[model samples]
Target: MDNSNMWIKHKNNRSIKEQVDILVKLTETHKKCIGLPKSKREVEFLKILYPASIRNLEIGDKFIGKTDYSAVGFGCVTSTSGVGYFFHKHKIDELKNNTKDKELLEKINLVEKYWCDKDTQENFRKELKKSNPEFFKKFAKNDNYSCVVCGFSRLSGMQLNYNKLLDLGVNGLKKSILSRNKDGKNDFYRASLEALDLFLDIANHFEIETRKLAQSLIGDKLEREEVLKVSNCLKEIKKGEKPKSFREAIQLTWLYGVVAGVVNYGRMDDYLGEYLLDDLNNDKLTEKEALDLVKSFWKMIAWRKTVMNGRVTIGGKGRRNEKAADKFAMIAMEATRINKDLEPQLTLRIYENQNKKLLEKGLEVISEGCTFPMIYNDEVNIPSVASAMNVSLKEAEDYVPFGCGEIILCGKSVGTPNVLINTLKALEVTLRNGYDRVNDVSLGYNTGKIEDFDTFDKLLEAYKTQLKIHIEELAKAQRLSYDVMKENCSFIYVSLLIDDCIEKGKELLSGGARHLGGTLEVYGNINSANSLTAIKKIVFEDEKINLKQLVHILDRNFNGFEEIRNELLNAPKYGNDEAEGDLMASKLHEYVCMCIKESAKDIGLDSFLAVVINNHSNTIWGRTTLASADGRKKGQFMANGNNPYNGTDINGPTAMLNSLTKLKTDIHAGSVQNMKFSRSMFKNHINIINQLLEVYFENGGSQLMITVVDPKELEKAYNNPTNYRNLIVRVGGFSARFVELDRQVQKEVMERTLYE
Candidate 1:
């Protein structure tokens, strides 16, 4: 029985009256779906909303999906938005305040009354808080920084198995589900089938839109041809047939991923390689044409605007077709070179005895000020990931770095960096005996104060104890979140796409994923390490300043303590390739990684580790973090990711890169090493840049994200934004136009050493 025509007709450009009618219908549908299984109820919601939500195909849009895609998946906060369907209370109130349309406001109120406390976030929080109050209390009390940031929503930060979707197509997926569910009575299977039906129906809508747009633009040959191509690709996929061309493959991948609310597209070249090669060999489309389609795909990606989340991988070992994959990778690099967009965070994975031209092209793009094609060293990462995730090297080969730089085993793992731990704050709380002076609360466990720790080693151990207490609590919150979400939403969409979900006949969070692991995001690691190194050198070794005296000076944020601050600043810094400082950082890194990893079994997780994958949160969190013993002022940004504190790496780029490789990454999920090179120096010297990266990676560097900018150009743009509209810089894990970044983020970027 075909259920595609069961939903009502969609009116995207609806007036106030149409929206009200749709909301009323959804309210009625919600009442009808009350007793059904949770997965089936979710499908019931989408069955109505999918057709009624927005749909349009731009004149030159090569990809079918748009920025305003009414996409949904297993998410906590994303229970509903748009069309005024299931709009949470907060959104409803905001809409009423912002809109002048009285009819729209009435509809919003009606939806809010019907679904005020029924949203996923509200329900998930209510249940999980009962189990993990300490983690929830921080958020409830509005303390954004208590050395840890956690929530019950653990759905984001996962990589969907797009390769499985592309390989199976629509019909194959449905067939597999049916085979698993022989009786056809399973709610997960039923919900999955219904979701597929919605997927097809949505594709049909885009096809019709594309056809109409093609007809209207018949006079313009170029644009008409593009939409028509998209129309044909949509027609093929919606009919459940395998894609025979590259355009068909890309169209299916984008439309499905966008509609499924999946941001990360892992190992694109590995999965889409065969179709790309097949199309090129058969002359179905020119190389330029395929590249244009990818550009359109990038357009849709940038349109989503998932800041620091859209990760696309290419060029690594273990590819079934390395030749085709490499070819696709070169094209992807070219696309990054041409598009100059912030998204899809094009990543290139290089290994031993592989092509170096790809690296040169990536550098060339970076020199053009496109902070993209972030480099990953397979030689270092593969072995490191195998140890970190506790998987075989074969499984680790499927490693894909999702949001920021947290690594998950591509399609097989559920590794979301669910909590953000502030290592520096751990030290701060230990120094003050569990008091968070900045927030004026007892945030961490009451470890002994500075006076009790007569030796530096004792102080460091106390700090570690504080970190462990907070990590276990926050980690328990993460685990309980998964357990709670499993009872409410089946995560059916991802279950269909994620590996072993169908085989296990269970949802993603219900023991379906191969590796049901979690990650904790650790920030201020280098700053904390620097503080320890500085204290070890200036206070303990020299005995010039006692621990209590130093804590007092730090409490004042270095006020009237200029001489002691200078002494701390003059101490050995990590990024200078100094052994004493780097070794301290190494010790702290191993402790945090092993601590988190070892707690996985106790927390009921397969594997839980730390990811120093810093985002803009580093700047935001640093603003509230108190001053430290490392000579940093209070409320100032800490070091971004594993890089040294800004302006501290004076010995230059090579030394900094050398120091970055010192910390072992094998036991942790992932880390980011950001470097900024002066455009004037490296732009004309691509060969030297190539050799430099080669030596760095060969010397055990795991990953690097480089930004090549002209000397003083960031200052030029920051001062006069209108002058440099296209000045892009690497901001932690993502790149953004310098003029568009938040001012503090801009300041942090400006402060990094621009090696010239």
Candidate 2:
């Protein structure tokens, strides 16, 4: 192991660029960090030294270390990364023996003995699979056809309490830890204190390393100045003292995210705005400088290359420093515009009284085709979150969307969307009397054949019944999974940052948060609803074909029934503001929400909310779902989010919103609604776009994620990648390079209905 990199403790054995690409592959594959060190201190040091290369600092770079993303670095953290290695030693050794490279094989040989601490997330999952075979079987079987998914091996990010971190410096936090130690009986609190101690030790090491780097840059004036700026910033934060300037505060903010392993930043304007104000008031920092610092931070975040990166929320109702925060909010908006990187998933929280300039700035960025700062309406989310979490309206003001647009109480709750339920798959099962054609397996209760349902109501009822069974199984499995996680793994770093953990002497997973809950991802809702609507309009209302005949058409993949398939395709679809289709969409959405809520409530969760945010799973899951009544051929992508089936929203953007906003937004946690517009629309009428957004929120639209791009540009990029390496599009819940996306996803983006 080489000491120079310190983070990896070894030379790449691979090139840095190779490492960066591998890091993204690992994250996309496992949905968590790639490697897990044994101790908390080791993890902290790794974060401090990650991305392990800082030699090529930009002209205005104020931070020295940038994360290269060699290892997994995202929100979810199990107790140990390598515990599975211990249990599966033979599997590990077999691979090592198969390795052709001597060095790689030597590294793999270390897993010869199975070893892990007594309590670990890896062990907990093993236990869950062993002790609850029935639950495991259901979850595992769901994976093939992918009716559902769970956080068996990977973890998701949680919203942290940045307010607390800012208010109580490291020294103050240490004092709080000391006070908690007076109780001494709680292992959770003890672990948190120990975690904090390691955090501070790493802080000290960072200060030393930063100052040394500064010293080395003395020959170059500009580099020296930037390095010294970073060093001074580190010095103020190292002792756990309140940051005196914008630089220090931002520096600490970045470090906290790195050490915590949760990249979703909670309400940045609320926490860092005051520091910006102080610097400006004292004439120590200029507006341009502050924006530059923010831009650099944005670069640092994007450096990790997460498909769904950190979210930095700005401008909302409940910010403690609302007036002061507005200045930096505008700056943050500009930074996002300039950075143009897919990450820090810049989000803007808006209310009726929000500053007009800030709102305009955010719109301007989105109009530029950045697809950011994704707008969230406080008018709906505030009250909705309050009802969902059963907290006061004031408390709900702290609510923020983390990865892929799910709301959790920042610093007060832990709500991981650990399971995915495919509503359309359930509909398929209902139609086939519980048979899954794609996976060739029988699942759930047989709800009778489609011909047995004489009325449309009977068919919907059967679909609902099947959906309920899946939801119940998922909720029960999630409950057991979290319990095992709580028993085996200690989320020390997370507990230290989230609320009431130290105060109540408990860890995050062990009931330390003020609110504890989970979220479920529901895919194919729009497609299934549309299919149901088609069945109602064509089969029941028009009496064009019998249920059995339609089922037969779908079963044969519509090979010889092209006219029937076209009729179904032409049936009134969701997102068209048509009563027949919109009503069905509303009904299915409400039913899914109710089932999830009840199941989550039964398991003692604060709230079990459903998110319709698509993680490009519509494309992946489509491969596993057979043909449907909606004229969707086998292996075609499902609808993305609450949006209508691709190419179906024929009526324009307003009608799309009319169809989408029909849902009771307050009941479900979050949903993503994506709309694409041609560049001409922005060139023609900015006011019309603004008014459209205003009316949507007034009508109860919760969130709007927009992408403004020309279809020709994307097509050209697809064929000639080198000509436009920087072109990006919003794939689903997140954005990525146009050429880097899966071919099917790129096709989906092209097929999105473009409003001119």
Candidate 3:
């Protein structure tokens, strides 16, 4: 991956330097607008953005915005240099001081009022509430206070229809776009053409700009040579043809993503690998140059400054063009080693026959504690996703992991986690006859008191009933909200890129995707399971405490009952691989999955599955949950994503792994497993760690999100934030600076047993 001579020649070149300068200028300019009042600034901002989206696809005389081989595009409508997406009103206060330009701000407010608003998917919530007040009221019955009940936010991240881009090429897509603009065209056709035309216009803008910049660089020997290369790449795309060079292919890919606001690059090695191999074979580019371009692109991806960086997945089954994908995957690994930036989160998919060197490289990256390239097991996920999505093995091969580890078919499905349900809260309601002690309300259905249940199975049955009702009500709410979005706030650009949309002549939101599903994020799994086990053992089986006494202790938040709380905590816990606790976990997981599947069918959805990847919501949900029979005090953060409650996984890492594999992952979309290893353990017992992972995946573990850090170092960082400014740790689905997390999150990280 090294070519020092090539680097020397291009290192001091003017074209590349100028491109960086332009990007930096644009980024700086965009940063200043962040603090401006949203109402005033939104209109002024959109006025500029509307034309940029519709027009500004051409190149400038300078090479700043022109990069034919780069992985990311410049000049997004909302943010210049692709620093971030459109700003939301709530983010205006990150500023330490107010902007002094009063008159300008006022003018911005006035201009914004006249501009037509682009309705986001979030608008559907308001519309759904307006149309069906009863549905919203049902979920919002607890005065919109409980994370268990009031979890109704529907947000989705995307993986572009790269198959369209890679297989059809720019020209082929243009033919489809143009065919739609006939007289008397339906709204779907008209909107699809409008969106596709805007895309082409954007392509032409970059092409023209690149050509002009190349022409201006004449007589400047080295820079002119480089600029013309860029110009040729752009001209190829402008002609609506497939990319003739690796550079042109990458440019087309980035620009399309920019226009569509789709960040995750679905199986890049599969899509772009063929062009790269062709270029290498034809002596058009060297490995070093390709590696350099990838690194540059990696930098662009990191610039977005969003929570989930654009995921560029490499090496998965069902990849159409597997030509030089392995070579590119290796190069991508090397590029991450060089760039060391947090995102373009390079995720590598591994199976039994995957290149061993690639796995070794991924381990090396993890060893360096960069927290990426995140590994996914095709052996487990392929089958798991196939079953959950009810798709064929070949179709399931297109499954891509989105933000926080939810699986959605890349070009074929829309499976967003639209609502969150707290299983632990259901347990609480079951115990107290439908009363929510924490929120001081009656939120769930009254199923009689725990004392009335003669057997533990009866108590479990009551809890199951509550879960089914909650899931049914929530699923209906989400389906209705999505229908409103489909009817009114159509995602035109997104529709044009996703599959079956153009084929059906309908929007992706409007049943155009091959599979339409909603994911319910079920948080506090281990917490609830452990609580049920404790109650079953101590109260019903052992008779260490009567049912009435246990209820009294729980209601008092476990105060003045330290001895009983200890007894409850000492009861067999999950993550210990004990049969008693593991059996309970299995039963609870089975019940949740059963309810989710039934609710999906009841609500007329193609698929609905549970995702236990509760990114930071474990803590949020804990805020509204009362003390449990597991001896957990009220308001304490719940367990983190199928992980055991804090300090409760008394057994070692292997036992914990075994316990996690107890759940039925095939019936679910995805779940996150967070495990921490001490630096010494990871470094010393690397082979053991590798074998453990292989066994876990082979045994049907869905996803493993590991955070390797020394407990001492983490504690130090938490105590002295300024000393370890760059220390990062994986929290659920994403990684962040260790010191920047909330105090409880930081504590949670510290509490995770550092395997040694």
Which model scores highest in lDDT?
Answer: 1
In candidate 2, what residue range of length 10 has the lowest lDDT sum? Answer: 1-10
Model 1, runs deviating above 4 Å: 1-24, 67-90, 98-104, 139-143, 146-148
Q: Model 1's lDDT to the true fold?
A: 0.78
Q: TM-score of each candidate? A: 0.94, 0.89, 0.84
lDDT of each: 0.78, 0.73, 0.68
Tens digits of lDDT, candidate 1, 436-508: 7877887767889678888888988898888888777767866865766676667667677788888887788
Where is the poorest 10-residue window by lDDT in model 1? 1-10
Stretches > 4 Å off in candidate 2: 1-61, 64-107, 112-128, 141-145, 148-155, 183-185
List model 3 lDDT by residue over 35-154, tens digit each: 643222322332234324332222212122222211112222211222112222321221112334565344333323322132232354566568657546546543333735654333
* Residue 481 shift from truth in candidate 2, angstroms: 2.6
